[model samples]
Target: MSKTFLKKRYGLLVLALTASGVALATVSQPDLPVAAAYKTERVVQELPMPKLTINANASSYWRDEEVRTGDTLALVLQRLGVSATSIQNFTKSSPIDLKTLELRAGQIVSARVDSVGDVTDIQFFRDDDNGERNLAAIERINGKWQLNTSNIDMETMPSLRSVVITSSSSGALSRAGVPVEIRTSLKEMFSEKFNLDELVEGDSVSLLYESLYFRGQEVATGDVLAAEVRTQGKTYRAYYFEHGDTGGNYYDENGNSLTRGFDGQPIENFKRISSPYGIRRHPVLGSIRMHTGIDYAAPIGTHILAPSDGVVTFSGWKGGYGNTVMLTHDNGVETLYGHMHAYVRGVNVGTRVKAGDVIGLVGSTGRSTGPHLHYEVRINGQHVNPATVALPTPKLSAADLAALKKYQQKTDETMAAVRGLPVMVAQRD
Candidate 1:
């Protein structure tokens, strides 16, 4: 054995070990993006099953059922699992008659069913033709129960409008593309104050009324918001306002209060009365009676206008006065007109009459000996001379003055903007 042979064997073993280590390192390195693209799919292990439990006692017992139109009470009872005897007893004891059970659509029925499939309680809720709901309840007690019924008032805000359509202005309004509904709404709104029948062909109307809308749909019109009327050469303005806690009357921009507290008087622009106001021999009565109101002899059928806006407290036949109309204005003022050919249609009790409205034609109706209108004015239920009664101007408070100034400025600006424009030529239809 020699030293040279031992060294050569040891060197060969070390080189072999080094070569094997390099080959192992190359195999252990991660693959590049391109090489990983073709890699084989790996199998995933299944997860363990989860435990779950549902308590039946905590579940809901009530069931909901939709009611269809033409469903009968017998059918409803059968659907609710109500026994025939129970239905008969319910029909007998029910406050609502059984024959009235013509079920409507979109109704809801709530029923409580026991474990044995017996109906414990049944509630029937259905909508009527007017879209009102009729609710009924039946409770099971010892295999027999009584029926209870009640009417539920649904809070609904319906839009309403009143329109006034006359051969005169209504036709023009219609031609202007104003809707018929609006016309009708306006008429209703001012029906109490103005009479559409009295409107002449050339007359014009200014409407102030409220329109109601429900969910964006126009439903109806409320009271008159405000209004103006121009017939012949006379103009009348009416305003709507609410009284405050201090019991003061409300007035509009034109300084006219909402009420005049009188009935029928010549509201048209008239000169001084021909006859004076005071107790004198009644020209028609032929007896010395107190002349309560001054006589203003205008043309025949010259619209007997309202001195102030108010309600028609009395309108109808008065024994000697012929066809008469009376209006109770705000603040304890009342006016009366007697001896008329005919009254404006729908000018009855509770009608809101406005200033300068033609209530009736001038023909002696009751005790009048001539075609002249016998007019009267009363204050606090006592007859007063209409000619000499000093009328008060509507006053403005500090806050109201400020508001008025602002409103006036805006109105002036609007008028200025339209000053140079062509006047809107309203064509009479």
Candidate 2:
């Protein structure tokens, strides 16, 4: 964009914020009004006290604790106020192998502790015998500890969160309960627009995302639906729009597309691009052959995520690329993931997945010598170098603009829910 356009964009404040709409928020406060017609009266009644049971928890409440780095089973239980005896019983009685429990930071563990500091029940998830993570819980049943490992039906819901910038963006997002996956998307969206580290103290951040709940507890978080960051006297926002069974893209309120490139990276935290697209030298074959995909070197079991929303057209083994998965997307675009250790459970043919959703694990499975992920992008079945994909600022048609406005209606509803609690409080006036 030209300097003149940038100046005009920044000059437009709030109501005229963008071509789509202004990012709005209000603190959640419900007002209770007193009834003027009712007269006040005081009454007291005497009642007999019932007998209390000894050595029983009179007040049991739920407490949540997050697993941290270098934390052990005992440490987590101790932090949750579980007594030593109860912790010992929990370990010995858990259906899943407590000794083999691998603690990953950021996982929430919920426990019910009594007034005396004895744990009555605790809920957590861990890798099962088959290497699949499943929800498991230990509860006191008839004075004996029992374990239950069952898959609870998941419920999908929308989540909105906001925070005033006061230190680092990551810390602020974490304190606001934004999921790590959603945080990544938010950062990527604004990475090209501004530097988050340079944001001033009063600048605010807000986000809308998809949340998954299992048995009333949030099990996982999905894609970021929308996000806004107010900094340097201006508000920049992006909204995610799903194009039916095809895929979704991020756009400014004005309906122009906004993304780092044509699409996002398939997996984050890869060591390096072990091999780039195009033919040079074949490592295993020792012959110059066409290298059709980009190889991302990462440790085995590292998650492979979908670059965008799409439906799985293929999920199985193929010639040299072992355990491959292929997805078909809009605009005749398709993506392929090869050399996988294993596919994420339930991500089979015809399964619809969103960007950031795990599809497989990284590994060296086919015609290779070490662990790496082979990612390929195909348009109309023709191979395109992933590294050369460029960002396009295409013009929107009249119908397209109308559809974009219709999509804004959804975000407008989300904005209203947070309208009273403005994140950019200092600049609201």
Candidate number with greatest TM-score: 2
Which tens-of-lDDT digit does each residue in 1-429 have in candidate 2?
Answer: 689855654465433546667564533333346667968899999999999779665598887777778888779989988889888877777656667787657666778889888887777655322112345556787777776433334556777777877787778767766655456557656666886667767788777776555556665554567777888888888877654322356788898776545444687664577766543423443322345567788999999988777899999887568889988765346788888899999999999988778999988777666888888765444454454332223446788778878877776676556542534211110
What is the C-alpha local distance difference test score of each model?
Answer: 0.51, 0.67
Winning model by lDDT: 2
Question: What's every prediction's RMSD, in angstroms?
Answer: 22.0, 24.3
lDDT of candidate 1?
Answer: 0.51
lDDT of 1 by residue, 99-210 (tens): 8666544344566655545455666543232112234556655545665422321222312112232466656554443334335434433344566546775566544334
Off by over 4 Å in 1: 1-274, 281-288, 390-429
Q: Candidate 2 regions off by >4 Å? A: 1-51, 55-57, 124-133, 137-140, 143-153, 262-401, 419-429
| Whole-model alpha-carbon lDDT for candidate 2 | 0.67
Candidate 2 deviation (Cα RMSD):
24.3
**Once all C-alphas are superposed, what RMSD does model 1 give against the true structure?**
22.0
